[model samples]
Target: MWALRRAYNPLKRRGFCIGTSRACGAKSELGSCHLDEKASVGEAAQVIADRSLSLKRFYSTTGDSSKFFMGRRSFSSQAGAKSSGEVDDDLEDGFSELESPASAEAILESNAEDENEDELISEPEPSEGDDEDAAVEEPQNELELSDTETDVTEKRSPRKGVPSALFKAIVAAPGLSVHNVLDKWVEEGNDLTRAEISLAMLNLRKRRMYGRALQLSEWLESTKRLDFVERDYASRLDLIAKIRGLHTAEKYIEKIPKSLRGEVIYRTLLANCVSINNVKKAEEVFNKMKDLEFSITPFACNQLLLLYKRFDKKKIADVLLLMEKENVKPSLFTYRILIDTKGQSNDITGMDQIVETMKAEGIEPDINTQAVLAKHYVAGGLKEKAEAVLKEMEGGNLNGNRWACQALLPLYAGLGKADEVGRVWKVCESNPRFDECMAAIEAWGKLNKIEAAEAVFDRMLKTAKKLSSKHYSALLKVYINHKMLVKGKDLVKRMADSGCKIGPLTWDALVKLYVEAGELEKADSILQKAVQQSQMRPMFCSYMVIMDQYTNRGDIHNSEKMFHRMRQAGYMSRLRPFQSLIQAYINAKAPAYGIRERMKADNVFPNKALAGQLAQVDAFRRTAVSDLLD
Candidate 1:
């Protein structure tokens, strides 16, 4: 699955068509930037919102979402600055408490038609809000580092091969607590090695079963059966942040032995803060690391890049300056972020120049970087440049990198290269990966080959016997694209019936399916259901889909609600949501009263495109007599 920054939007994601949706239950591939409605949304943009590095966060009711870094900026004024006909409610109350990230969550939980019918599947579509950088992003930094014990964790097979007895007992046990299970396993004199525990942790985290993972960590810590290394502490901190709130993780830091409270633990917390887009807290944590006189890692700096890439691009230069001061050589991910920023800005020359600089430093462009280049080149309408980059990705050796197929499929599809898509598919035809299959479905769907896409889905279902909702989402996307509402519904029904875990990606597909089918009410209902699930955050596209539909209908009231809900859901699309809100008011032949003030309250200034929309909205307003006298 893909983990794009921002939106990597279908219609608007700048380049690298992959979005956070790709990071669903499947492995999140790095190729796209986290991008947004306008620009600057990446894997971190939503969950690439992680760099979907490509950082990705998956929401799960089974446990806390794997990633989240979201909080509102402290505007000069917000709560005291309302220009309203109606008063604020608990939703705005959440936004008002800027200091505590915990108080900022304002999800409205409502029971859907099938609330308890079946368990939901893997983390659904990349929320595009989760900071998607799953690969070069945090998971690499957060979990598997070459120096850490978790390196062995990554080597263990993903889903195949024999699972350890500890794993079986943990899974077989009911509820998140597997103490009895662990006790029984130990009672039978089954030995527990750190490697075995590491493998079990890998399996649990992979399945997004963070609660059980936490329990496992707690058991390890409480039992003290094995020696605790810095990595063990770091891993536990990450799981704490992942399962508990960031604040809880912050508190856990004090519990760490002072000597063991090294750079890794603090950076882990910082990464979590950045993951949520909690700018103030991220800054505080980053500053704290400096106060402690710790050597800053590129991982830490990249965390800032991930944060600013979404919420504040202006601050990115500052982070770069610090990296320079600290002599932190830019990693491939650093260059990728820089390149993506330039690409998002449409500065093709700058992007290329960054690559040139990266090469000059002897850091060759990796597969993900090449993918980013192709994406931007296509976005810039430089077809040949894009193709040249794609050729570079293919290189002389097809077997050099198995993962390159994930990048290839989408870049080709973005170029509308149907033949190339199929050719790439042939190479992986012998044993396609989950992510590769996802890319093929997307590529085929983009090329309008619904049947081919469906065939891939069918094959995936048969091969991957217990496919997640993410798998279903691929086909659902195909159906939505072709406007086959009945088929889309049938697929969704089958997913639920099969007891696949419903998630953000699934919700996004459902919302799009209904919206495209002209059922705004149903679409709205589905979004509400997603909002109700505390662990999940809806994709920016999902909210935009319904909001835009309301704007089309000139239903300003519902549009405003969706807009508010979106902000509450941790999405801050700088333009699209506002444009929809204003357009709704304009279309309804009503004055967008105090719209400017509202934008100011959120620290959003109108650009040329927005100014034009505002101009139309302002034209209908009654001029004040006092202003005329003045």
Candidate 2:
């Protein structure tokens, strides 16, 4: 329907894949007005300003708020990895979806990696002082525990900058309140600066120390030694969403000073919604953003684009139409998303046209583009075209473009070019990055070169200081595909011996490995253990594995259990589990009674294939012999 609408739109003359059949309209107290092709960005912005007239009167601009609009857009463009919810849930749920991955907490908690590790980062103490307005004097009272502070780092704060030493002390003093830690630093005569505090939090965030990062933010807000900016509030709001949940984050928004709440803040909420794959919530937030008269940035648009790209692609045109109306420029991320969307529909011609338009806009395609292009080309069986793109990517000095090398390994392997994988990997082998090593292992595994994959894994173990569970999962994937259950188990042990944190990926790997070994019960048992042990819920993929196995055997009870467990784990937005449940019912030749009602509740509409099957099953709905006897 979106594509059809796009066809008749006036923008058809521009040859864009995106268009609006109706004139773009904005709502404001002044009344509705149509934005046409003649509408300049300046005019659109003026309309936005007028729309927010009431809020503007209450909270005047300091100019920084504008940065969040343009700044977030510019930043997202360069974040090729954010394309991953193409995977962070990247591009974690990257730029963490590409973790190859919130709600904000979902993405943040995910960005933080495995919830068990999150337990290491101290939750900020609930204090009257935590209310940004309240400034109680005694730090000890603010953190009212019988303070036998067990220092994580086991070192005293050195006589350095308070912010700098504070970072070190917090790392050393996990489980201790950050407010207390800051109190200790202040007592030792160290002064603090906002920049230093910002830098330290950046480090914590970079290392996935979201718990610690969150604690620091709370302490900063309580201290009130520094002024709070819109960005500061936005950052704290996002951290809360990450460590806490969206509900908590939403509550915190009201607590923020009215002037400090704006697009950046709501954008954070929208991103978390997208990360969670909540079509309903995300749309609510996006509409809320518009109603509040915020100029929709590419970050916001891209988040929506990413969301639709995953769940409801028909809505992407609506978003693009909104962007065009808003005069919001498309970033490389935007173009990349559009290209992928077209490719996903197998529209080769449409895809290339977008690429040409992107080039005409003077935006040079990067490694991520080539990677996506190769994938689409290969999927369309354009082997020669895919290879040509790969060749161009490999052109000139491969040494400068390490991204191309990383993208190449997997791309080459997909084409069954084992030798080409080797050639690119040989370049990486000289001084290996962790990701390159991961890619190399995956490539060899795809080629069924198990020994080579093992050698790469071994090299990583020796050279990479310490590897995370994800690193081990790469090799584990190879073993699982080859049905080498023994090796997979051995790798899990090695992971534990290395003191690696077991996250969803490891749990998924273990499930697949066991299931592939014809030990369905073991896989089910493993999922149970994961539910019990992991602070991070096991991925729905693991549940699907066990569910699929049970469905195959017509073990309806077990399949239903898996389905219920998946919803309990907060993975209800996806349709895959629902399909698995229905398939199980079908295999059992029983009507999937009340399934349509359940689907409606969950907002999952069956496609034509599923709908037809559901109709068949619904017609056969009857009380079974066992139920009648009962």
Candidate lDDT values, in order: 0.61, 0.60
TM-score of 2: 0.74
The Cα error of candidate 2 at residue 523, in Å, is: 0.8
Candidate 1: residue 95 lDDT (0-100): 17
Among all candidates shown, the one with the greatest TM-score = 2
Task: List, residue by residue over 1-630, the lDDT tens digit for candidate 1.
Answer: 011222222225333333322332133223222334333343223322212221222111222322233222211111121121112221110111111110101100000001111111222222111222121111212333224344534454464234567776787778655877787777898889876887777656555556777788888888787687776787788878776668889888888888888887887787667545566677668667766667777777776775565444544543554455456776666777777767766778667767777777788877666777787888788999999988888886656766678778867887899998988899888898776788788788878888898898888887865666556766786788788999998988898897676665677778888988888999999889777864666666677778888888999889999989988876562545677798888889887878888887775655444666787788544567746876
Scored against the true structure, residue 326 in model 2 reaches a CA lDDT of 62
Candidate 2, residue 283: how far the Cα is off, in Å: 1.0
Error of 1 at 149 (Å): 9.0
Residue-by-residue lDDT tens digits, candidate 2, 547-589: 8889888778999999899888877755667666777787888
